[model samples]
Target: MTIADLHTLTGAYAVGALPEREAADFRGHLTRCAACAQEVREFRETAARLALAVAEVPPAALRVRVMAALPEVRQLPPVPAGARGRVVSLRDRRWRHRLPYLAAAACLVAAAVATGVAVEARRDADTQRDRGVVAEQRARVVSALAAAPDAAFHTGALTGGGSATVVSSTRLGAAAILYRDLPPLPGSRVYELWYSRDDVMVPAGLVDTKDPSGSLLLQGHPNGAVGVGVTVEPHGGSDTPSGSPLVVVPL
Candidate 1:
């Protein structure tokens, strides 16, 4: 294929639809063309996600039915040694005409599976990298708040069990909460933090109920909030406190 033709093959290449020679040419081009490479990457990711969104599980009896019918299916008989120029049946001719298309379809299916696996792997790596960056930034904020000259600490006992410690730095305009020996909640429930200001509470962040003992840097600056409160909420958390605070530590 010409160079211009190779440039248009990104979509086909991403889906493994290119012939072997053309695909090889495009692969070489991709190494030197950053834009084409990026487009191909995006195309693959979109295709993979679309495939996953429409995928379904087959019925459990499907394999059994297929196996049962296999025994009754006829197989093509082999030709005699001297029958090279013999007339071919219409059925044989039809099968010959369809052979290439069937092979191509199989190749496409295999390519799609391979693309999905690659996309999932890349997504997982990106997620891990993002988590690491977030964790590092949180640690820095927590440390800075703890070291501030105006930092004040308050500890309160939770209503049902355990305790919560709040470290507030008015000068830094932030606070952090550390939960200790907190009891695990139901799978559908979670611990959410809030900042109380003028008797109005604003959501801070959600705590992982599975790890009862953990710490979180509240979502926003304290902004003269009176205290920090923890409460039980649905798994994704609530816009406002759904129930009374489990623990409230005055700032």
Candidate 2:
């Protein structure tokens, strides 16, 4: 695959979605590219985190109900030879007695399936609503910081490529970072912003990997912070930086 095409496989590789031949090629590329290697590590960690986040245990009641219904769901016996012309016998009566039990079991299964679908739909709706609210709040914060009278902007070069611009406002008590020409990270990795206070790095916010060049409104106030630092972190971000800053811009 071409170099540009290979770059796009970082996500697939991290999730083990790549074919054997393609994965081998990507491994070769990783040896020569420090940035790609770091991205791969971040992607793997992100995938693990996501797996844990969405995992759910089946309800105990559901299991119990399924087990209880198993005995009631029996297979009907085949008709005996020449039985079609005979009168209803004991075997026929027994089969007739099981009809209601069979119907009840089928209804129970249908009800369970309906309940599951309804629950899933409600959960998805709630999640979407929460995301919308968060996005709206973030947009307002970013806009306010941009328009603040005391806002000051500083630019710094990143380690591998591109540059970062940090905008801090004493009036708004907040900061924002704008990434320019930044390389895209794997789905499992994110660009994290930090506030440097007394040589200690505090996680400020996470930049979306999908939009590497987009802007992010940093969390917490920028007060007492000497500067802002940007680093690559796993999907969710780190409480403290895991490595040296890719770029640090004075506040």
Candidate 3:
């Protein structure tokens, strides 16, 4: 999808209204686009306040009246792709993507005010905003791991099969890694990352090795870590190491 199309869905994404595929795509976009992430965060915060401001109950008769009116209403046909731009307001420079957002905003306002959906909507916005922050931070860490002046990298062979490589920057306080040619783990477990300090291992983050190879962002003290290790842990990861290292590299 175009960036503009993704932009139009920012509100929908903030409120969990996008279709599953589009929502997944937008979330992937969120990891790499700080501007979009920040926009989603702001929109979510505003949506939450709107939710809290609209706590009144609608009159009982209103639903009955709306249901009564539906049969007489005529539906408009879908606009053709070529003719869709005919409604543009030539006066506005930002008209390109505003229509969808305006429509989404109007729907949000109506839903929040009329349905009294404040609690659910506010909770979702808060959760989505927090996720945006985490995704954006991971993106920053990955970028720093690649671009920072103090960046360092180490590579080693994995147990059973394959090879692992870690790249990190002490100045940036983050690390990232890529792996190749590894066997997948069992359904009950996945790979998790850890760092070393003071002769002890600290849980740095986790990654899926289900594909047997992929990349992941590992934030927090990658720069200062004395070593890096990967282990097999339960899906949510263990607070402490739960298995012997599949790959270990002393930095």
| Highest-lDDT candidate | 1
TM-score leaderboard ranking: 1, 2, 3
Model 2 accuracy (lDDT, Cα):
0.73
Error of 2 at 5 (Å): 54
Candidate 1: give the clashing pairs.
none
Off by over 4 Å in 3: 1-141
Worst 10 residues of 2 by lDDT: 49-58
Q: Write the per-residue lDDT of candidate 2 for residues 50-100, one digit (tens) a residue.
A: 233223343465456556655654555686789777788899789779988
lDDT of 3 by residue, 1-251 (tens): 88867765665576566779989999988998888788678656543432332223435554565565445434335757997566666655486468678767766666655454445445656766775666556544454344444555577887888777776666666677666667777787877788877767788787755556556666566555678888889989988898788878777
TM-score of each: 0.50, 0.46, 0.44
Model 1 residue 200 CA deviation in Å: 2.0
Highest TM-score among the candidates is held by which one? Answer: 1
Better of 1 and 3 by TM-score: 1
